[model samples]
Target: MKKRSLLFGLMATLVLSFASSAVADTKRVLILQSYHAEYPWVTDVNQGIRDALEEERFTEGDNLTLTTFYMDTKRHTDDAWKQAKAREALALIKSLSPDVIVASDDNAQSLVVRYLKDTSWPVVFTGVNADPRDYGFLDSLEAPGHNVTGCLERERFQGSIRLLKRVIPDASRIAVISDNGPTSRPILRRIKTQATESNLNITGIKAASSFEEWKQFVREMQTRADALVVVTYHVVTNEKGEEVPPGEVLRWTLENNRLPEVGFWKWAVEDGLLLSEAISGFQQGYHAGTLAAFILDGQAPREFAVTTPQRGERCINLSRAEALGIAIPRDLQTVTTLFKTQRVVK
Candidate 1:
């Protein structure tokens, strides 16, 4: 009887020990994102988020539980629906109260901030362009002063124009489409200043707030613009006040014209954008993910200043340009990040 009791005690102790170890190994992360379902770049961002968590040894199905909620994929156009979806996501997040919340872009970050700022959960965001100071997310890049810090998707505007010049050797006139958002003004001014200094004929086309206006604006530029430079998609807001993919608008513009479309994201290639001297959204996600994982693993968010990865790929679709009868300059080809062929349905 004593032997039987001793065996039972041993089994109980082993079970308790196992349970403690399992609890210690489990790590949970919640991603409050906006654009994963239909957006190609968000998939890359999700992969980077996974990669970042994995780098910290938090493997999925073993030590990690990643809960992702995409609020702006299918209901991106309906403002009321988008808010309702966000509210539902917030309720779920508030219930789980995960270790960390990784937001992919400015809009996503804003959503998380709206719903989770009062809570103690840390938020690590990527692709935020408006200054942290003005946005109230942090005091400065050197010291975030809050539980929010990640990667910046900002870029060198002059470099992009130089790339455009390289791609279209004889191209001199450039048209910039902007939406007058907080992020657009600085970039427009800086790029315009630099492009003007370089003797490039650049025109800043301020787009209206409506889709019809956008189409009309594009149509107007088609007559005078040598090449179309697509600024951030922030100009193309959905009914929910969220930025929709700018590629569709550009694609519509290019359908009848023969101008080159230069965009910032690699998916722009898939969207029929001719080339990009800009950063890859996947690479940006990877960088952002690394920092987010670090913060989630007990590292302080303010410990790291805002980081901007200068490394980016120069993606070019040679066939895209050729379809428009636009020649790719040799020098531009030398520095091209990606060169591939895709059919334009016309």
Candidate 2:
């Protein structure tokens, strides 16, 4: 009886050892999203990350654990609020002690990855519009030369401009309109450069932070510019000087604006813009997730190169085109995703 009892005890010890080993092998990933959870752009990017993680057989609560933090920076634009939220995010990161960190968008990169660069934990970032060099995150696109690597959200200005030209053959002078937000600044610069190269005269570049200012600029552009290229309106304030929702801004712009409109995001087309050559936010997150997976699997972030999205979607709003008395080529109709209403596809 003594011998049998000892044998059972040994088996139990071995089982516990194996269970502990399994737990130790599990990887923990923390995702830092710079926008609200309800934001479609944020949700789409999160979905892409989830899909990529699933592809690697990383199931949550089993062999992989995933945690997410949404900074809600889009709604709260004040410097003090942002600083406080940054501190909160940093504290959370310290407590979690994640194995890998995946940051999404410019705010995350600026707020979280900026402080944690070259640390023990690896970081992969996506949806950054500003040049990575601007933040000293990498030596070059080819090699990060640090413990950070991921995809850059290249401005789709040229493609969208080309599409706009195709649809509006007589459009000579164009005006670029965007809110005076951090994300739009880099993109607006790129658009100005591309506009000059494309030989399309830039009549005006209006960066407005309030509804009245945006309306005034749009009214001016309607009379002078042949077409309007809307970048983003997330930071625009309403009449009361309070922050307004992007959807409301788009709705107002669609109802009031007269010029043929084009933009870089697919959702813009659904939101009343006439055409777009959209960069996929989902693919950006997927690439970032791919980098995170590599780091979790024992590969250094420096081993992987920074990437730019290879695919773009041609999106057109047929109803908006018709409303503006513009004609879309038959070939474009055959190849592009056409929407008749303001309903956006996720």
- Which residue pairs does candidate 1 place in steric collision? 314-337
Write model 2 residue lDDT over 1-346, tens digit each, in one string: 9999999999999999999999999989999999888776788788888878877777788899899998889989888888888898899889988999889999988877888887787888899899987777788889889988889898688888788889877878988899999999999898888878888899999889898888888888888998888999889898788988787788878888889888887777877789999878788878888778878888999988888878888999999989888889999899898889876422
lDDT of 1: 0.70
Whole-model Cα lDDT per candidate?
A: 0.70, 0.86
TM-scores for all candidates? 0.84, 0.93
Tens-place lDDT per residue, model 1, 64-101, is 88898887633254557666777777787778877877
* Residue 46 lDDT (model 2): 88
